[model samples]
Target: MNEEPRLSAQDMIERLEPALSPMTRIRAVAALLAGLAGAVFVGTLWWSEPGPLPGRTQLAFAVFTVFCLAWAGYGGWLLTRRAALFATDRVIAAWIGLVASLTTTGIVTAVAVRRGTGTGPALAVGGLFVAVALVLTVRAHARRAALLRRVRELTGPEE
Candidate 1:
């Protein structure tokens, strides 16, 4: 039977260096840190509050804290398991982040509007978050395209 040679550890590391870019690492770390901190902060406040609160308010706090925890878990998994994100993976992750941001923004803005207070500020802040996520998503797509182009160039005209 014919056999393909395996890449040595050093060779693998060399190839992986590109996939593990600084920007990718930064994004992963930022997500992990932000999510974790938010979760902890919210949970602490929810636990340490004095006096009774409305049932709905308590539920909201719990739900928000859980959502933050979910984000932290996702970020942790990505940092450890998907540290060396390929071009395709990077694009997918970026899109997921964008969607998550947009969804959160929409929910927050809607809640503020429904409460009949702080609607303007909520909308503005949410819009800014969506804009940032969109920019990141676009950059991820562009980077993936450029990397694919480079790979095709290296692999000759067959592609």
Candidate 2:
């Protein structure tokens, strides 16, 4: 006897939606702004100060920042395309978003620590942002997994 049942579109939406409230989106946006600001601060220091290996370090940092931005943009594109495609598995996209957030957090943390700018506050804020972003990512993954499970349940056993 087949055990899996077929899932409908509505059922899929119900399973996949995390119901991310408006407040959460706002918080994420705020965090992103703060990260951008931190990047600017770091850039100022990197350019203003003269130290050993300054050119190499600054170049490396610039490249890393650009790469991270590109990664973030790519993640956005993937998400948009996935939405247009009505794709059910969002695990990869969600993880991409998560990685972008983590990367931003890392950049901010590095800048704050390297500059010796009394990092307690920056670290705290960045950490909070990272934590929330991670939580959001996990929720998204859970929703995707739930939908896949529901779909498999509806499909039943195959010969």
Candidate 3:
């Protein structure tokens, strides 16, 4: 079977740079959605809590709020930075950051479900965030690896 030759990292970057503008726009929309979701979460908590939340649940909410903000910031960075070249290394770093963020969200949600009172709808929303985060992380890692391989091919073995 015939196989296509791989393009070099630089070549790939050259091709992708043109697409970055649209990608940046997409990232901005995602950021706005994430911020909206955070607002909804806060609203739900306030609405649902007929009584005061325990100290731990309060703390979880605080932490999750910050996490959501950070996600927004990341999206903002992607939007503003058209100079953004997804170096293979940067992709790996992004994946790591995203995983850490998602893990924290998962743990907090688990604790809230077990110890704090939560609504079914809220829990489902949290679960959706986790799933989306996982999918994004996987895609980022795959892109990074592909870039790295392309970089290797471009440089080749030194004589």
Which candidate gets the maximum TM-score versus the true structure?
Answer: 1
Task: Tell me how candidate 1 scores on lDDT.
Answer: 0.73
- The digit string of per-residue lDDT tens for model 2 on 46-157 reads 6677666556476657755654454444434443331212233245545655666677666677777888887787778877877876787788777877766776676566
Distance (Å) between predicted and true CA of 63, model 1?
4.9
Q: What ranking emerges by lDDT with the best candidate at the front?
A: 1, 3, 2
What's the best-to-worst order under TM-score?
1, 3, 2
How many clashes would you count in candidate 1? 0
Q: lDDT per model, in order?
A: 0.73, 0.58, 0.64
Which residue ranges in model 2 land beyond 4 Å of their true spot?
1-90
Question: Which stretches of model 3 miss by more than 4 angstroms?
Answer: 1-19, 36-52, 87-136, 155-159
lDDT tens digits by residue: candidate 1, 30-143? 877888999999999998999998786687787778667766776776676533344655676667667767777777876787788877888788889889889988998999
